[model samples]
Target: MGSAVLVLAIGVWLVQDGVRTELPPRPSSAQSFPAAAAPADDGRQRATKPSIPGMGASPPIRIRIRAILVDAPVIPLTLDAEGHLEPPPPDDNNLVGWYEGGVAPGQNGTAVMAGHVDNKRGLSVFYGLGSLRPGAEVEIERKDRTTAVFSIDAVEEYPKDRYPSDKVYGETSRPELRLITCGGRFSKETGYQSNVVAYAHLTRAKSA
Candidate 1:
């Protein structure tokens, strides 16, 4: 299906309907790129183990990206009356929103999570997401107390008008995850013009 068709199927409309007037001012270059310590490993050790059977459907409670030192709580999100996936409340910049009705992280399908790149106050939880490289780790702690580990496969940006919904929300045989945030040039009149999406697949899972 095309981007438009997939938009409705996968709840991409909410992203397009952002309230431009509510956006905060952009951060300076220095504020946007804080230096982070390197991770001990490249987030690939989990790739060596096999995923637990039938363990991919648990609700995710938190997400951590060690490379950028991001550890944030996750809240469940649902579609609104307009058929759009609800975004995290604008007041909570540190929280990420997971599509509760969709595939859970580590499930055998694409799981979706989104966060604010920044808020009116300053940088948000995913402010550094654009800096993540391939092989970086994205660990999702689920309600089951088990952790689903994923290895970054790619990071991409697309104009909001040309979002590749099929690729972002497409079905997959292996457990996969998609992290999204607003990106690209910010416009005072239009807000952010692009969306950043990080693609990754479940490499392994560890019990609490």
Candidate 2:
């Protein structure tokens, strides 16, 4: 299907809904690049590619969510015409995009990733993520053969307009990660009416 068709299949009514997603008014030059949705080749796990500033190198990260032992593919944060981050595809319900500007998975501060709870089909990679309870473990594996494990601290659902801006995108000193996707009631007019955000914290790290 075309991009527009695929978008409507989810809840993205407009391709570039938000016009200008200004980065925090700070002294950084990190530009947001649009990440491509994971190919719907199969349920097989694909390696994640990180984006580098100069070389434009593709970096890969390995992630493990202990509660579900999920090994998802991560992509760099990029924006569409509206300047909003581009989302991953609902490939077998798997595919996620990480906001690179926030923080590295194993490093300090919040590391955010966005996924589709479900597609026009029915379920997405994180369809059941809301079921994750506190204390659950979420791991992020880096190419350097190291794994960072995070524990689920909270799972919340928020309205789009009232999304927790500070809490969700705010800076922090501890290494934290947020898994976001569309949730709540659905309508033919709108695929998903709300968003589900799962918050997690780094609890362990080991050489992989």
Candidate 3:
């Protein structure tokens, strides 16, 4: 996904009572947001191991982030008629949505995934997303019976109005993954004040 074609509009679901007991953590002060002109070093040590080669396109079936105890099913998400990306059904709080229009996870491009931070009931699938730190692992299981393992590089939150679409949705030479959800402040009228994004690149790939 490129900046021009990126049309995601996430974190719109309202939480119960218009408030949440716990908000996801922000990126450590040492990390810096990627630059719009070019990707910047997030101040984290790059993995010593070389990145795995990209794979053929396959729909992701599941996503796991052991550091945050996330293990959820992955569903395909599409752009609505209005060009905005549609979120997963609110009825299933544990589900994650993948942008089907983009390259699938493990492919030679940035893959995007999203989930609700919380629903009317409470915390949802990506409630702990912002808490993840550099070096953490994110595993995506694909229909082809393989798992793409990624290592986190940075996590940051941006106000909705100022979202860096080019940085977050930019094309990449190697396989990369992005996980997103609502973050920052909340209110009855505005839902979430910002969106949290975790950037990572494929470190390993294995058979199921």
**lDDT of each structure?**
0.68, 0.52, 0.77
The better candidate by TM-score, 2 or 3, is 3
Summed over model 2, clashes come to 7
Error of 3 at 4 (Å): 5.7
| Full-model lDDT, candidate 3 | 0.77
Model 3 lDDT-worst window of ten: 37-46
What TM-score do all the candidates reach, one by one? 0.77, 0.68, 0.87
Considering summed lDDT, which 10 consecutive residues are worst modelled in model 2? Answer: 23-32
For each of the candidates, give the backbone clash count: 0, 7, 0
Over the stretch 1-208, how does candidate 2's per-residue lDDT look in tens digits? 1223222222352111211222111111111111332111112211232211111112337555656546677776555666455566434445667665455676765566766555555455565666677667776666667677776655766565565466555554456677766666555554456666676666666775
- Using lDDT as the measure, name the better of candidate 1 and candidate 3: 3
Index of the highest-TM-score prediction: 3
The most accurate candidate by lDDT is 3
User: What pairs collide in candidate 2?
Assistant: 33-78, 34-78, 48-60, 49-59, 50-59, 62-141, 93-125
Q: For candidate 1, what is the TM-score? A: 0.77
* Model 2: CA > 4 A from native: 1-60, 90-92
Clashing pairs in 1: none
